[model samples]
Target chain A: MQMDLVFVGWNHRVASLDLREKLSFTPERAREAMEGLFREKILTEGAVVSTCNRAEIYGLTDLDDSFEALASYFSRFHDVDGSVLRESALSGRGDVTVRHLFRVASGLDSMVLGEAQILGQIRDAHRRATEAGTARTVTHRLFQAALECGKKVRTRTALGTRPTSVPGIALSLVGRIFEEVADCRVLLLGAGETVELTARLLADDGVTRMSFCNRTQEKAAALAAEFGGTVVPWEERIPAFAAADVVLTATGATDPVIPGPEAKRALSKARRRGPLLVLDMAVPRDVDPAVEDVADVYRYDLDAFGELARANAAERQAEVPLAEAIVEESVEKFAAWLASLSMTEVVKQLRFKLEAIRRDELARSEPRLARLDPADREMVERLTEALLNKILHNPTVGLKHGDASQRLELAAAVRTLFKLDGEGRE
Target chain B: MASPSSPGLTNALLGVLALAAYALASVFYTAYLRHPRLKAGRLATGLAVLGAALNFSFLYARSLALKNVPYADLLGSMALFGFFLAGMNLVLEVRHHDRSLGPFLMPVSLLFLLLAFVLPAGGEKRPNLKGAIFAFHVTLNMLSYAAFAVAAALSGLYLVLGKKLKHRSKNVLAGPTARLPSLGYLERAARTSLGVGVVTLAAGLSMGFAWGYHVWRVDHPFWLLDAKIWGAGLTLLFYFVVLVRAHRGAAPVTTARLCIAGFVLVLLSYTAVNLFFSRIHSFT
Candidate 1:
């Protein structure tokens, strides 16, 4: 097998979001890039994966010269210098490469750890490569194994359970205090994408009643209409907070919009009948961090949300060893099957050599048997064939039952003892 | 010639095998939670399967010896229910690749299996028609209970892990636990199980009513005022409420709590009717 594998990519470990944004490839751009790589004759088989956290180029190539060529291709395609691309690139060969791909697919190497979305992302990459006519038997098997490893890890472990995202976190918190979301009311303090996403998450969890109060009333009304929530005027945001059981703030304000005093006043108005979950996803802090100290007000800042996400990411990382063990076991099982192919050739050669020896001996004895009856000669030939069969049976059985290491040792012994090849004597 | 009606040997073997398997599976699952090796998990699953098979054989032999369905007696019913739960757990584990559920599921299975050994094994066989209806009721009820068990476990996990994720904690256990299916999936599962429980309860109750009316006049009945019947009716109502709330899109955590409570009621009804109360249905 020609062992050639290359991973040209950027991820959370090697690059910041700013760098990733510049390097990220849209599906259309990825397709164009793959085609470009093919035109440059840098690789025979290739796939591209682009996600919020990662953008990777996986390919198989034979020429030693092609590695540099492929690295330079990534730089030119992403409008970056060769040195910048090289710093983030990872390359491996043979088993290491196979293991790496399996780990990635299994979510052992994911930014979020155990996220299920990456498996679909990998499948999409493989599908696109096949569509581009770049995926051959080797790449196909490699990708298929990776997908299987991902599935096995998911089913056999608890690594993929629970939401790790900010939106997911906010909804889960709201779920805890309320028996059901239908009875709970929500107040959203922004009209940005983060708030919209959080609203969608909460809606999915059965939080039907909500109020959106943004700096702009039009933006609030528009967002509220999509989710069937009412829009509150910005001036009455604190009073709106009193009506809500949960508050999520993700505004673009330079300072805290919902101060600690305002939060405390709202909490007192509700008479602490229910807790208020506040999610502050703004960079500059939409809600004062001190609001968390208020009784019955659970406020989480961006850092806290990020820590939860990271902690969840770490928990998933812990499962990586177990997931890798499964992948390793699978790879060994597959390699044994591959090794068995060599046994077929060995068996064929042994039979051919044995048959040649039998024929030579028969030829020498032909003149002596010519004087005997035809029936007697036929009996001698049958006896000779049976003796040869008996001798070969034990080795053949051993080869079938044994793994690659055992088979290799046995094959070596057979070749050396029989001197089947003249080079064995040397 | 000796009589062939004794299941002494078969019952003993089954009891031993079931207990051993239950213990082994529980340990393996616990180890799997800690180490999470596929080898350990696969071993646990295999033992569970073997245990189920042995339990099935025991039930068959017992049924043959008694010349009636094995579920007729309290012990036999408990054993049958245990087998059903164990079988369901294995299937779910295999299907979802979720072994975290084992610690929760195996104890329930083992408890039933142990109860099976303690209760009397032989009972008076009812008529064939009544026996068929009895079997139908018990089987469906057991299946519904199994589904509810799963829903309860998933919901419990969701409540804890969901809370941790929300607070943005760094707890490893909270992070690695599989994301509970969207609240929608859990609610749907809970509703479906509740619906099945209700339907099964209705069928069972209706059959009891028909049988009671036949034995007595319209105004007076032999088993009309049985505690088992009332308990079952109440349990059905509980699930009815759960189903309604779920249909209206209840939060998964809330629905899960209801499901857990409903299942607990089911267990109480099943136990009280079979073990403590005497009624026309208590042929055991």
Candidate 2:
């Protein structure tokens, strides 16, 4: 019989976030659920992979209606509505299942395309299933292959190397301007949400010094308090520019807050370790446009950031075909292995059935054979064996090369026609 | 001035092969800039090292042919400049762990090799290159010129990267600028080259002046007033000003532009002044 495995899931594409959250499994919950599946005899082996954006199950099952069994298991486990689960569910069996698991591991199926966290999530899910005695050899093989494919895609593609989000862009921009972010001071012109987010990202990148200035003193003080830094009064922000290596501005100003000549003079007096970087993320602008003409200053307004984000998105999207090709090749290999397993069974059953028939006929004619010479009897036996070997050769060769589905169908046909399964389990 | 004789066939062949090797190395380095995962950077460095060895062997063979030193002529001097540049580039690549600079630096040495092929080799014995003092002056001058070339290349990169950043972040990140280090790093590296240039150029000019006053006083009493000396002196003065003032106070872009201008003056002093207006001395 073919080793039939199945994949079932709801992800960001098919399910609402609320449904996904309800379906999400912690490690303990996933392990308990898989153990319950074994107890119920619903699956031979299974793994539940649960994360913020998706929860998927991979299983090795003998049941013909294993997809429906798994769908009902979600209702029993998470108490989610069965109708909603069935509607949002994505189901694939055999090689389709293998491809689905590989895609998810490779981050092609992630909410954020090509994000790396899913690979680790897949590993953790596999680990929990193994610990719960739910993932045996077949499930283990499938997950190991998925992990390998994920690693290959990450290394071979440029999907995850470039930054796309605003915080990510801010970090990349800082990297481009400063040799070392730790030694530099950042001056925030306003403590609005964008400015606040920029502060947190810069802090994470190892900027030890940050001075916050805002129209609201409490907001500036609050940002400064959270990340160890000083707070400058709003009026003295221009003079504070002299101390900053990177100046981030997102204030609600009608006119330019940092004038071209004044900003130039103030930044000229700035302690020189690197070129001054200014990011004007404000609406009516904070830094003057003329500041871009300054020799030591590197400036990026809001439009530049958006353009860079779009380019990163396009570049990442372009890597999909290449990643999918890897997934396809991996799935084909899995299919071939499953085919080989089925071929082995078919060959064994055919040989056994033929040998049993030959033995029974020989036993019934034993007395008549005894009348012949010993050499004649041996020749008769050899002829029978040679005929059986010749019969099995052609069918075995045909079975060896086809896909898993073809091999499974051919194996089932051989079993039923020959009555190789004595109890008629076929 | 000493006018070295024509190089032997063997020495000329080695020099041409060395130049070809360096040119190929530059192609690999440029490829590395575009596709870093190809790992062509290491191969580029290997080829560059091979070229430097061959170039050295050529210099040695030429010296053996002349039965004295090799750098007494214009061709020999240019070849020495190329060799020093190749060596300096290797050092920079190692220090910065950056392969993008190879495309910028290797072509300069290639140009020097090309110029060496066209210029006449001076006689082995007697003009402005008579003694050990003259060799010392010429070697120092060549080293200084190589340093200026490095500064100019890095400064050119700085200007290009700055222009790229102003126009679009995507353009900067996707293009060749992606392979470059930060603008601050480039500026600092160029500044370091400028410092080395200033020191070496000062020493070379001092040696030239003392040697000139000592040797040319009796024969050409007005040798100090030669167009070559004035051009070299002005080039030195311009670099010295830029190195001291333009770097510390002026904007980095202005500093980079000044550095490029300083290199222009150096080329003029080396090429235009020596070719047209030098009265008592001839390196070629």
Candidate 3:
């Protein structure tokens, strides 16, 4: 009833990899440590989410120093100086704790913004704590609600819709240029690793017809065989520009493979009506910069593509307010549920007191009641239980349904009237 | 008959209610497009459908009072045109499973309904010709015009979206361009609407000519000189060419531009020709 939430964590934004690795907990070790935490009485409930990018400890505590104790516990368990833990990471209290966990679970606070893996990590952490018997009502509900919030944010907002990685950026660029990737013919130059990775991603995004061109035709043939495409001879790679709707070049050649003038002449000769999107992904740039000046030919080199990635990140950032709104809604809901826990305690105690009285009255009247048949006696027991439930029904409903502040008043009144637990229990 | 206590029971009140619904739907759809998190798209679709229903009620009231198809007058035809627009858009929106076009398309119907209000009521002109053929001709033409209106809306959006995509604009959330369909989708949808418009216009124009052959004398001095007749012929020709080009998979931008031009011809045919200088036609 007197629980308060606290969080102690360090992420890539604040701590170096060395510190994060030092502070991280394995699943088996986390459970063992959480049981020790229960014995130490620092937290009533706790969960530890330890991943490559972050190590977070979430808990319900009643002591004023539980946050400090968590920091100290981390240093002691990991054999680091307590001051180093304090200096590198900070703790969040109550609402801040809830908000931090929600943001992390929703992928808003991830190293790669809007990455979807954090939600599963949080779920696993909560599960481990539950299996360890260290996660009770509040910890379980908080994580469950956070997971729901994470899902809603993913679905209802387009925060995670933008691509951030290199292959993802290539997919997004293709999507923006071509309305239907399934209909476009993709030409992947240089059967290198970058091109292979991009080809696989593009294939998954519905690029069916692919043509691979490499100086080493065998490498091109191998990649084409793997991704179900044909390999064009290296001599015919320039003419292949006229045939391709999209051209992605990532060759390690020290020079431009498709020169701007040659591409312009070839594209002009073909008189292609639609756009020719060329992504020059090589370090030295596979396609010459002048190809962009050609009419209806859109070209972006590696740096220009990085600009696209940055712009995509900015767009994802713009959706933060929307994601934050969802997180805010979940936090308010958790707060209300937490407040209702107090009322729940009153209801539990009131029922316990009523049941005790019921048993005592039945015991005191045992001789008189023992004269009834076994069936009648059983019916009497059921009747008393039903009567007790009926008496509790309205007050319980009234306590649960109203606003939190009003419910607090009703809970207080119930506590005082029932005289079960006084205000001193507050 | 709907009772007077009902909101849109009276013809005048029905026009007002339908117009109001269309107006609110426009705002909601626009809001939904700009900020999809607002969750206004469904409500906007519902309002548009309600507006269409009210427009149908208006037509039903006119039909009940006059025992006709309710397109005999300028006002009645305008209301019917708006009704068909909303009706066809609802069909397309549901069919495509994309509600983003509502904001762009609803205002056309709203404009027609507003024009209906400013004009005289249905009783101003009773049915001049009362045969099934004549009714089919008028109704088909109105429905064809409605389809063209939808095609025009989709084409306009296609042009804007295609331009934004071609330019590779990152401001996907800015202005009215947000939530616009992909260029391919818009092109395909516009072509579909244009195709329906052409087929319906072909049928309706044929019916008109057949009925006119019986109704109006072929040897009349000014029969071929009717501005509406020339307008209809020109619009049909231009749109038929656009449809052919689109069917052949022309560049989407060219197809979008041609569809837009075709809609311009349709507007001229529907408005300038219908309202002003058509000697043999006085349709609005």
lDDT for model 2, please.
Answer: 0.82
Q: Write the per-residue lDDT of candidate 3 for residues A18-60, one digit (tens) a residue.
A: 9999988898888877877777777767799999998888887
The lDDT for every candidate, in the order shown, is 0.70, 0.82, 0.79
Per-residue lDDT over A273-324 for candidate 2, one digit per residue giving the tens place of the 0 to 100 score: 4477888899888999887676667788888889988887787899899999
lDDT (10s digit) by residue, model 2, range B1-284: 11235557888889889999899988998888877755687889999999889888888998888776677777787888999899899999999888878998998888887788876654435645556777678888889999999999999998888877766658566546767888878888889999998899889889888889889999999998999899888888888988887555667788899899899998988887887789776565
* Better DockQ candidate (1, 3): 3
Model 2 TM: 0.83
Tell me the interface RMSD of every candidate, in Å.
7.8, 2.2, 3.9
lDDT of 1 at A425: 19
In model 2, which runs have C-alpha deviations exceeding 4 angstroms?
A123-141, A252-265, A268-273, A329-426, B1-5, B120-132, B210-214
Model 2 residue A199 lDDT score: 84
User: Candidate 3, clashing residue pairs?
Assistant: none
* Best-to-worst ranking by lDDT: 2, 3, 1
Docking class of 3: incorrect
Scored against the true structure, residue A79 in model 1 reaches a CA lDDT of: 84
lDDT of 3 at A231: 92
CA lDDT, candidate 2, residue A178: 69
Q: For the second chain of model 3, what is the TM-score against the true structure's chain B?
A: 0.89
lDDT of 1 by residue, A323-365 (tens): 7789898777555433433555566667777878888999998
Model 3 DockQ reads: 0.22
Each candidate's clash count: 7, 7, 0
